[model samples]
Structure formats: C-alpha cells, structure tokens
Target: MATTFIWPFIILQCVTVVVIVLFLRMFLHRQLEIGMGRIKRMDKENLEKEVELNDRLEKLNEEYDMKIQNAEKQADSLINMAKETAKKMRDSERVKAKEEAKRIIASALQEKEKVLSEATRMVNSKAVDFSILILERVFSEDELSGLRHRVTKEVTGVLFGSDNVGELIRKNKDIEVVTADKLTAPDRKYILKMIEKQAKGKVNVKFVVDKSILGGLILKIGGSMIDGGIAYRVNKAVLELREEI
Candidate 1:
C-alpha cells in the first residue's frame, strides 16, 4: 500500500511540472514576438528618416549648383562691364590730350601774332618818311591775285592732305565736318560716297559752319578729332617756332 501511494504522488508532481513548463514556454514566445515587432517598426521609421534626409540633401545640392552657375554668370557680366568702363576712360583721356594740344597751339599762335604786330609798329615808326605808294601802284590787281592763288595752294597742301582726309572720311561714317563755309554739291557727294562704301549703309554726316576753324575743314568723329585746317597749321607752326626759341 505504501509503495502504491508513493508512485501516485510522484505521477501527480510530474504532471503539474509539465503543465507549468508549457505555460511558461507560451508566455516567453509571445513576449519575444512583441519585442521583434517593435524592433521592425523602429527599423522602418529609421529607414524613412534616412530617405527623407537624402532627398533634402539632393535638393540642397541642386540649389547650390544653380546658385553657383548664376554667380558665375553675374561675375562674367561684371568683368565685361569693368572692361568696357576702362576702355571708355582710356578713350576719354585721349580726347582730353588732343584738346590740350590744340589749346597749346592756339596760345602759341596768339603770342606770335602779338610779336609780329609789335615789330610792324616799330618798323612803321622808324620809316615815318618812307612811302609804299610806288610799289602798291606798280603791282597790278591781276598780278596780286595770281600771287594769292599760289600761296593758297601751298597753304592748303601743307595744312590738309587729300589722302588723310579721304581715309578719315571712309573710316568715320557718323562724322561732324566743321568748315568756315558750306560745302559745294560735288564735294558733299564725294564725301558721302567715300563713307558709304565702308559703312555699307547711309552715312550720318553733319555739317557745321564755324569761321573759328579759319579755312579748310575739321572733322570730329566719336573720340577722334582730325585737325586739318588753316588755323591749326598756322598755330602748329607758331608752336614749333616758340619751342625753338
């Protein structure tokens, strides 16, 4: 009886232990599944964040490249503007120099005229008794006219060369021709034809009648001035004489 009772207790203990073991195993498996599900959710959120960050970085890079291109274009424009400004400044300086030279020539001519007038007055005072009536009567009007013509030809050639004037006419279409008198019809036509050939279009030629240039013509185009006139030649000659003195 004792042995049979002992075996029945042992069997009951074994059955309880087996039930407890199965319950514990099921609880642990559920807990592990819950943990694995949370881990997967966290991993998905991290991946989404990474994708969004990559997209933002890509946009920023594109923006940066666009900005760089715009900056480069602006820089190039600025550089070109600077170059144009510098060229304009240089051309302006050259124009100023030419004007200064003209002024110097004018001053020298005035001084020479003053000296010549003084000398003439001195000679007239010294020769109070002498008379030019005989010589004035001897030279006929026609002879005096011929002498004036010869002097005019030499003066015109020395002051203004046809070749240089022609080249200037061809190069500058928008020209300002300053002269003591109005141009003749044939002269105007010749000038227009010469300029039109180089311009390939209608030339804008402006005529200015200024007696101050004395005779011949003075041409002004853009920043350039061609001083081809009687007044300029006389002034230049006076300047050379003053320099030598």
Candidate 2:
C-alpha cells in the first residue's frame, strides 16, 4: 500500500513539470519573432539612405563636368578672337605704312621737278647773257674803229631788207646822219646812194660829225634811229634779248 501511494505522487510531479516547460518555450518563441522584425526594418532603412547618397554624388559629378566643358569652349573662343584681332591690326598698319611711303615719294618727285625747272631757266638766261658779253668784247675799244667799214655795209644790208626797205620808203622823211669821223665826199655820196635805193626815192640827208659815236654812223629819222656801230648794236641786242627773256 505505501508503494502504491508513492507511484501516484510521482506521476503527478511529472505532469506539472511538463506543463511548465511548454509554457516557457512558447514565451521565448514570441520574443524571437519580435527581435527578427526589428532587425529587418533597420536594414531596409540603411539601404535607402545609401541609395540617396549615391544619386546625389552622381549629380554633382555631372554638373562639374558640364561646367568644365563650357570653360574650355570659352577659352578657345577667346584665343581665336585674339588672333583675328591681331591679324587685322597688322594688316591695317602695313597698308598705312605703304600709303605713307607713296606719299613721300610723290612729294619728293614734285620737289625735284620744281628744282630742275628753275635750274634750267636760270641756265638758259645765263647762257644768253654770256653770248651778249662775248659779242660786246669782240668789238670793244680800238677793235670797233677797224670794224666801221664792215658795220656800214651791214647796216646798208639791213636797211635794204624786205621789211625795212618798205618801212623806210613809207616814212619819206628827211634823215640826219652823224658819224665819229669826217665823211669823205665819195663815202657820203655812196651812203646817200644806198639810202635812196632802199627808200625807193631820192631822200634828203643832213650830215653832222660827232666823235661820241666811237666809230661808224648813226642815222636818225623822226623818233627812230639806226646805229651802224658795233658797240651800239651789241648793247641794243642785249637789252632786247633781256626784255624778251
């Protein structure tokens, strides 16, 4: 009977222990499920934040690249513009220099022409004067005395020239003859005959002696004079030539 009572008590203890174990297992399983859900939610949030950071970094890199490309393009444009401007300036300066040189050459040529013209004029004038002086020296002083006969002949020839003969014939005035030497009768007669021939009629002549004539003869009619003297002819020619020049 004691054995039988002890067995019943042991059975009852075993049942209580089993019930406690089962309750404890159920509580631990619920706690594990709650912990797993919290872990999964935290991992999801971390992944989303990493994606956002990566996208922002990519956008910033793109912006930087675009700005760098624009800067390079602007630099190239500036370099080309500078080169064009320099070329234009150089071309303009070269043209201006060429024009200036042409102007200088033209001015020099004009001045040279003016100087040459003046020099030629002066030379021509001097040459004419020198010729007159040489002629004057040929019949100067005693030389003139010896040339009187030739001078008288030349004068008669001039009086009988085509134009002069007609002019003297038209005048029909009395002529006065002055000479440095006394006229011999034959010389006077010959001179009167020459005058009458050129005048185309008999012309009255009055003669006078004047040593101031140096040599040869002077014929005066009204306001006109014909000097048959080397010195006088040379002087008159000089005066007329100078006036013409």
Candidate 3:
C-alpha cells in the first residue's frame, strides 16, 4: 500500500510545473510585439518632418538664384551708362581742344600780318625820300642855263612880236617894261635914250643878278611871264606830259 501511494504523488507534481512554464512564455512574447510597434510609428513621424525641411531648402536656393540674376542685370546697365557718359565727355573735350587751337593760330596770323604791314610802310617811306634826293641831285646847273634861254626868247616876243602881242601892247598904257637885271653904264645910256623916244620915265627897271636865274632878261608888262630860257620851256613841256597820266 505505501509504494503505490508515493508514485501517484510524484506524477501530479511534474504536470503542475510544466503548466506554469508555458503560461510565463506566452506573456513575455506579447510584451515584446507591443514594444516593436511603438518604435515603427515614431520612425514614420521623423521621415515626414525630414521631407518638409528638404522642400524649404529647395525654395531658399531658388530665391538666391533669382536675386543673383537681378544683380547681374543691374550691373550690366550701370556699366553701359558709364561707358556712354565717358564717350560723350571725350568727344566734347576733343572739340574744345580743336577750337582753342584754331583761335590761337588765327591770333598768331593776325599779329604777323600787322608786323608785315608796318615794315612795308616804313620801307616805302624810305624809298620815297631816297627818290626825292636823287631827283634834286640830277637837276643841277644845266637846269639853270636852260631856264635863262627860254626867258629871253619870251621877253623879246612880248616887246616886239609877229603874233598878236605887238597889237596888245600898243593898245595898253600899262604895258611898261619891267626888268630885274642891273643897268650897267653902257646898258643904262642906251635904255634911257630909247625910253625918251617912247615913254619917258614910264619904263621902270628893277635890277638883280641871281646865279639861280642863269642869265636872262625877264619882262612882265602884263599878267604874263614870257619864258625865253631853254629850261623853263622844257620843264613846262615835261610837266604837261606828266599831267596826261
């Protein structure tokens, strides 16, 4: 009876330990599955936030590119304007320089012309003075001799001539003989005797001996000069020729 009762109690204890072990294993497995699901949900949320940040970065890059393009366009316009302004300034300066040079040249030419004109006038005046001196030198003693000869011939004609002079003198009592030469002893005796036969004391004789006269008897009874010298006649002819021009 004791051996049979001990064997039955041992078998019941082994079954109870097996049942406890199986229940513990199921509980631990369920707890592990719930932890893994929570980790997966958190990872999904992080990926969504990352996508939004990437999109913002792309928008910022596009704005930066647009700003850079605007800056380049503005720079190009400024450079072109500067170049045009510089070109206009250079052209204006060139024109101003050319006009200044022309004015300077014209002033120099005017001064030169004035100097030349003054020099020419001085040279002409000197030449005229020289010509006058030459003319005076050329007309020497021969000129005087020619003058006397012409005067004598004119005087003789006036006293007694074949032309109308003789008739003119006989009609006028104012036709008295007037002489500038001195009456010598022999010359006065003959003239006095001839005057007594014609008009007494009416013929007045004035006397003078000018070497410049070149020897001539000048008689002026009327408002006329009777030129008898060669010089006076020749000089008158030359004067007439000169007047023709």
TM-score winner: 1
The whole-model C-alpha lDDT of candidate 2 against the native structure comes to 0.73
* Model 2 CA RMSD to the hidden true structure, in angstroms: 15.3
**Candidate 2 — which pairs collide?**
none
lDDT (C-alpha) at residue 128 in model 2: 53
Better of 2 and 3 by lDDT: 2
Model 2 misses residue 174 by how many Å?
40
What ordering of candidates by TM-score runs from best to worst? 1, 2, 3
Looking at model 2, report the run of 10 residues with the lowest lDDT sum. 229-238
Residue-wise lDDT of candidate 1 within 1-245, one digit each (tens)?
A: 99999998999999988888888888888888998898999899989999999999999999999999999999999999999999999999999999999999999999999999888556543333132233237767666445433443454454334565556656666787676556667666755565565455676888888855545666686667877655565556555655696
What TM-score against the true fold does each predicted structure earn? Answer: 0.44, 0.42, 0.38
lDDT by residue for model 2 (1-245), tens: 99999988998888877887787777777777787778777777777877887888888889889889899889999999999999999999999999999999999999999998787566655655565466468767556555666666666566556476448655866888887767779888887887777777888889998864545677777677777755465556655776897
Instruction: Please report, in order, the local distance difference test score of every candidate based on alpha carbons.
Output: 0.68, 0.73, 0.57
**On residues 127-169, what C-alpha lDDT tens digit does candidate 3 reach at each position?**
4445445645776656634544445445544445433444444
TM-score of 1: 0.44
Q: Runs in model 1 with CA error above 4 Å?
A: 1-13, 113-129, 132-245
Residue 50, model 1, lDDT:
90
